[model samples]
Target: MKNDTPKVFKSIFALFVVAIFMIGLFYAFVSMPKGWGVNVNNRVSRLYILKNVRTATRLLDSGKFFAKGMKPLRAEVPYKPIKFKKTANLEDGAANVVTSIVVDYRGFDTLGEVTVLFLAASGVMMLLFGKRVKPKRKKTEPSLIMYVGTRIAFAVIFLFGIYIFVHGHLTPGGGFPGGAVIASGILGLFLGRNGYTPNHAGLKVFESLSGIAFVIIGLIGLFSVKSFLANFLPTGIIGNLYSAGFISLIYIAIGMKVGSELAAVVDSMIGDTKEEWS
Candidate 1:
């Protein structure tokens, strides 16, 4: 009863704090500036809403809002020194500006993101170490149907992943999504094949080599162009397979590194689980 008293008090206190927080949040939301809220009757507000609706309708009908020879919308005080869309292809040689930004203009940030992902994968393995205990029972083999289907699907999925990363400069997919897709294919193998296991040494080698290559490419840019991760190579023709200069190369490196790292993580996790069941 004494121990229960503290628990009850703690629960009540938590609920009270949550209630206070909710009230404050609601008050702040309601206290926002009047002009920010919907005003159907206001003349200026109606005109602004009608303008947005017309613009949206036009975009929906034409499948585009901006066209050649039309003046682009701009803020009274523009922030960027150079417009992004105007120079994206010229600067990075990528048809997809989003890819150009992710793999070229803001490449160092992407490198940091890759580092974080690698660390997370490594951390999972490290944290789960020494906790694996092999069971004293024999493991059963996977069904023939499952094994055959997985084998066929694995190749297709891996090829699709390769295609996504290879054409990232010209398409919607990039290194991160492509690597994740490749890792998913490896995971399918882990689940469907009874005796299949990823080669840890090979994954490590690939991961290390890819990471080193990315840094080396960045260093080359720094030395030759006075900028880290600068587009040192010729951009080539836009939308071509060989276009986008160093963007595709960096994305390839990132794809390899991420795919290997994630595959290693899945391997470690599945291996530990298999050991526990063994």
Candidate 2:
């Protein structure tokens, strides 16, 4: 009877959990509010110093003669100059800046994404090769590029990955894309050799350094600068390599860390696992 009571309690608890989960799922999908339109009553100020728009009604049939492409009228707040250092002048002569921002200026997002990649690689390794048992090794060598020349070619390819990362602030590609390219080099290495794995320890080292660099930079804002991500860097002459203060340094670190971590993760997935049991 005591055992029966315990079983009954367990069943009740399970049912209660299921019911709560079902209700939560129901509310999450069915009753979530999406603010589609502007709410005048809930105005929030911005640190970018932009001003509220006094009038935003379309100039339809008005005397103002805008150009051909200005027909589409829109309401927006007044523009204001954000209190940040200029990034126009950099040593690397690159035109595109959005990519630089993602890979260098806003590198926190990249770090989170790289961590996700690491977790994914670890999960794959655990799923396929964890708790290993004795199994027959597949003895056949892969007939793909196993030549010495191929490895030499891949060395150049890996260098190209580094080039991409280093020039990330100057070009369109940043950490994520550059990392993928670097991972391709490691993939070539894995395909060309037996049991060759990417450097996981090196990846950890690079990742830690990049994270520390980002934290130190953010800390500088607390003491030297007012805003959290305010670019207090000195803007050197535009169009010069290394001209953008701090941003250039930030991007290079992000590129190296991202490339190393991603390459290591992919290599681990493909090369580290042993032969599966039949």
lDDT at residue 199 of model 2 (Cα atoms): 58
Worst 10 residues of 1 by lDDT: 73-82
Number of the top candidate by lDDT?
Answer: 1
Q: What are the TM-scores, per candidate, against the unseen true structure?
A: 0.70, 0.57
The sequence of per-residue lDDT tens digits that candidate 2 reaches over residues 147-227 is 575588788987887777666655666556666777677677777766665556777788778857766776686578665
Q: Which residue segments of model 1 deviate by more than 4 Å? A: 1-89, 130-140, 273-278
lDDT per residue, candidate 1, 40-117, as tens digits? Answer: 443323322222333444554684544433444311112223232443334346777678778776789998998999
TM-score of 2: 0.57
Per-candidate clash tally:
1, 8
Clashes of 2: 8
The candidate 2 region of ten consecutive residues with least summed lDDT is 47-56
